[model samples]
Target: MSAQPAETASGFATEGFDPATATIVAVTYNRSHLLAGLLESIVRMDPKPGHVVVIDNASSDDTTQVVESFRDRLGAELVYRRLQENTGGSGGFSEGMRVAYELGSTWMWLMDDDVEVLPDGLARMGAWAPRFKSIQGRRYDYDGSEFYWQYRVSVPLGIPIPFAPAGFDDAGYRPMNSGCFEGMFIHRDVVRRIGLPDPRFFIYWDDTIYGWLASRVTRSAIVNEFVLKRTREIRQWDMGTRHLNASSNMYRYHIMRNRGIMAHYYRAHGAYRPVYFAIGTAATFVKEIIRLVFVERTVRGTSNLWRGLRDGARIRRDPSFRVMPPLEEAPS
Candidate 1:
């Protein structure tokens, strides 16, 4: 990717005003390899964004230096922030938005660092910006790899479900409640109103909740005309604990607990949502019990199931399970 800046007029007649205003923020945690690949794609953006912020999630493995090396080359166009510890993508993006907003950004694009960006991703998104208040997301070459948890429904359940308006069906994705962080481009005004991604959800389904929140603030659409390629298995939550792994019982815990959170938020807020979460949780618990008893593979994973059961039984109060680092507000 080339870092050639588009020539903006310079002189007293041209007040350092930049008309091409958009910012893309990529969030990463220790995946310097993925971060470098995504950065190369940013350099190739045709109508490149005014800036890109790489929010490093406390990566211990040289990710800070990797991004710094890139910024040293890109200068003001690429700014990097290294947090003290990994806060998952939710915390990374929350802090990332804080950083992007300070840089005079008019719009923000949320993406994960471990991916290949579509050369025209931002340009096409910018083209559609005038049409809607927000764009949900789209990923390239998707064969259901990462995680496609479930379908989304806009408006509360008791209320009639609304259909996507004209002009979005061609994309082949339903215009639903929310979207993931993959390639969602957010207009700056919405962020000012809705605030950042909910950090209460440390790891699971936070995007779904965020998408629901985004819809309340603005009319949204899922755009797949362009896409990003991510090389991971997508949503590797409940990944069995192994050496050198950041395993958290929170994966199961959040699934169990967040179901209650969603239920309270939407059902009380009156979406008449399904108990599908409850059903899934119950089924998983039964399977875990069977595995532990029959297959006889008793490991920390069993404890994870126990955590899920405990949290699910009392899901109301178990909101955020993360320990925040002592860090300053995002730099202005």
Candidate 2:
């Protein structure tokens, strides 16, 4: 949150690569082409994963076709589970984690659909995870190549921090913004306690909320370059546009509604203020305006965000605008 130097993202592999790792679990609703590239890298891991699971969240495209193309090459080594409904990213990720749980993997690597694991992801993250355990409360470069620490409010480089640690190192461990997700290889035992990410967060911030919780139960903060993520991607697009286009309905519905929901906890009890949340709550409205007037000239998506905010202000239970299980593990 403080003014820090621009992050060094390019050299993460060499300066921070870790090569010893195990199974990885990823989710993809579509874009099997992109996923195939990631899966290919996983197979080449040094200590190959005992299992790799991909939960297809009802993708309309030839996603299954894409995955199947690689079946013979990866064998049962890669397991694919096609879903019946599109519950959203939270659901998709939860389903993948559930599969990882069933496999009894010591660790589960979490990856996004549009992201690619660095060539040395497994070995790098695996190696750093332990070395990280030694330092405790600190983050290492993806391949154990570099370490980044929070100086005042900004994170800067220290030395090369190993990706993983063999034993617990309570030195400077901090849970990630979203605890462990976004290409995180989680420990099995931790799952039994924490369960999967909160299913309520349908569109965004599920990770941030999860990190707050994880901080209470474990030390999980980290900065790794084990994977290269397309940080920005469209969940949907209107007739035409380069920017992500959301349904006028969902924008009004989930994105807007979830703002108040997240603020209730994140701001009130989770350390946020209503005023700040209000300012943030307005961002969606602003973006929608820009899209309508400048970027895409679309009124539908922006309108939906308004409707979502209206509904969100009424929410008191879980802030996210979603209908999911109260808090339960996905079926195995």
Best by lDDT: 1
Minimal lDDT window, size 10, model 2: 151-160
Q: Give the alpha-carbon lDDT of every model.
A: 0.61, 0.54
TM-score of each: 0.70, 0.64
| Candidate 2 C-alpha lDDT tens digits along 215-290 | 4455564533334433334343332212334334543466666665565545443465555456666755675566
> In candidate 2, residue 35 scores what lDDT?
81
What are the per-residue Cα lDDT tens digits for candidate 1 across 50-133? 788888877889887777777744423887788887787778888888888878787788888777766656655655566665
Provide the RMSD of all predictions against the true structure, rounded to 1 decimal.
8.7, 10.8
